[model samples]
Target: MPDTRYTFLDTPIGALLLAGADERLRCIGFPTGKGAVTPRADWHRDDAAFAEARRQLSAYFEGRLTRFDLDLDPRGTPFQRAVWEELTCIPPGETISYGALARRIGRPSASRAVGAANGANPLPIVVPCHRVIGAAGSLTGFAGGLDTKKWLLALERGATSRVSEQLSLL
Candidate 1:
């Protein structure tokens, strides 16, 4: 697509690369660890393009905002999109297993597929994929790393300052 814009926003976790085209947020990339995303050669850097997202993300990191209100345009398959949509419905401070997530999407037999979709989520925090955990309620792998996931869950559970303190050292 033409006119794809990007900008980096500093957060407690790290610098998140926000990128998309035509005012729609397509991807939110972590700065370090497993899911780091670099800018494309053809993409243009424009902070103003993602100002709203930057503001919302800042509020989220500070525990001032729970649900995001931005125009999201995450790209994925039809099933993945369904899984991601259900992910948004999961309340904050709560965890759901991959099997339960699959059940929520009416594909109860696709727990593994659900996990794969969760792993492929382009927007991590905003999309709430981190809320999905193992069957026994153990923390699972995260695109932004396990520590970031722990902080995110903790922030949702009213440990705002604790999360801030822990992540600020990063």
Candidate 2:
């Protein structure tokens, strides 16, 4: 594999690690936890490579941007990739159960599998894996922890309301 450029950015949640290659974002890792992506010896620290990601992420945190328009190249199995793709389709401020995600991918019996894929997602916020919840509307497991998930959901909800309010004014 080619060398991946990476950098760290501080956010409301904490520090986030951004990695990419050839101008396409490859991963958005948490600072520490099961989902954390540790620094690799081959990885190069390049803030310029992650400038756009940092900008968009900042906008997202500030509730000024909802959709991310960037090149993504997360490496995973075909099934995992499919799960991640569907995850991106989940609008901000909305939540979907693992079973619902499984059904959406045409594998109704693979809720557990879908959960696993969601857990293993290399790109978290951009992929929006935090939007997944339990069937009963409970906040489920997240790579960045449930607290972080709740914050993300709250951020999106607040952003949605702000956008709606702005639209109402116009």
Candidate 3:
């Protein structure tokens, strides 16, 4: 494997671990739980390597950025990659159920599998897996915990409302 650089970023939820190589972001781990990815021995700390990601994330939190434009190279199974790719298409402040996501990927009966893949997503906020919810619109399982998921959804909603208000003035 190539040399990967990592950095810890403090966010409203908690500190996040960002890892990447060759300018392609590979992972964004939470501080703990299933979402956490331990830094490898070969990994080196380099804030500069993740400056763009950090900047974009900050903008997102501040409601100044709606979409992320960065090179991503998350590692996962083909099905998981498909799920993650579909996740990126979910607009900010919008959400879909696991069943919906499964159908979107041409697997109408793979809702469980899709949820599993979502739980194992290597990148969370960037991939937007948190946007997936239960069929009844309940906040479901999130690698970063349900509270964090609620916070993210609320943040996006607030940002969307703010953007709408700004646009209405024009």
Candidate 4:
């Protein structure tokens, strides 16, 4: 608990709670549901600490940025961390089943475990947890709730399409 600082950033999804220390992002909380977060009793609020994050997130929502580049320090088990890292490999607008993700990590029989890790992701959109779907292609549970997940998927899909359309007209 190295003097962790926190801030709230507003985006299309909703107001987000960001917490971290020493310039590395630790957690990003959604506006509602179990993921909603409020500053802890000892947490300090500093807008300047998260300026770059705010800018990047805003750009993302506005479709100006496609991916996030930031220092992240999400706390989780080694297996969970591996899942989160693999999540980033899922290109925006594309999705895969938990079973597929499990195999990607060389754990073909660990779909359930992969789903669990996805649900427990400390970082959502940045890590792209919303891209993991049910085996039958149905959108699954997300910490930020299904609606937010749908919105993010739509945003990514739309952004990707626009990019492709731009390149094709050249």
Estimated TM-score for each candidate? 0.94, 0.90, 0.89, 0.91
Clashes of each: 0, 0, 0, 0
On the 0 to 100 scale, the lDDT of residue 9 in model 3 is: 88
Off by over 4 Å in 4: 159-170
lDDT on C-alpha atoms for all candidate structures: 0.91, 0.88, 0.88, 0.86
lDDT winner, 1 or 2: 1
Tell me the alpha-carbon RMSD of every candidate: 1.7, 5.9, 5.9, 5.8
Ranking by lDDT: 1, 3, 2, 4
Better model by lDDT: candidate 2 vs candidate 4: 2
Query: Among all windows of ten consecutive residues in candidate 1, which has the lowest summed lDDT?
Result: 159-168
Number of clashes found in candidate 4: 0
| Tens-digit lDDT string for candidate 4 (33-121) | 97787888988999888788888888988877878999999989988999999999999889999999999999999999999999888
Question: How many Å off is the CA of 25 in candidate 3?
Answer: 0.6
Model 4, residue 44: displacement in angstroms? 0.7
The best candidate by TM-score is 1
lDDT of 1 by residue, 15-72 (tens): 9999998878999999988789999998999988878889999998888999999998
Candidate 1's TM-score reads 0.94
The segments of candidate 2 whose C-alpha lies over 4 angstroms from its true place after superposition are 159-170
Candidates sorted by TM-score, best first: 1, 4, 2, 3
For candidate 2, lDDT tens digit of each residue in 20-40? 897789989888777788779
> Looking at candidate 4, what is the lDDT of residue 40?
88
**Model 2 — TM-score against the truth?**
0.90
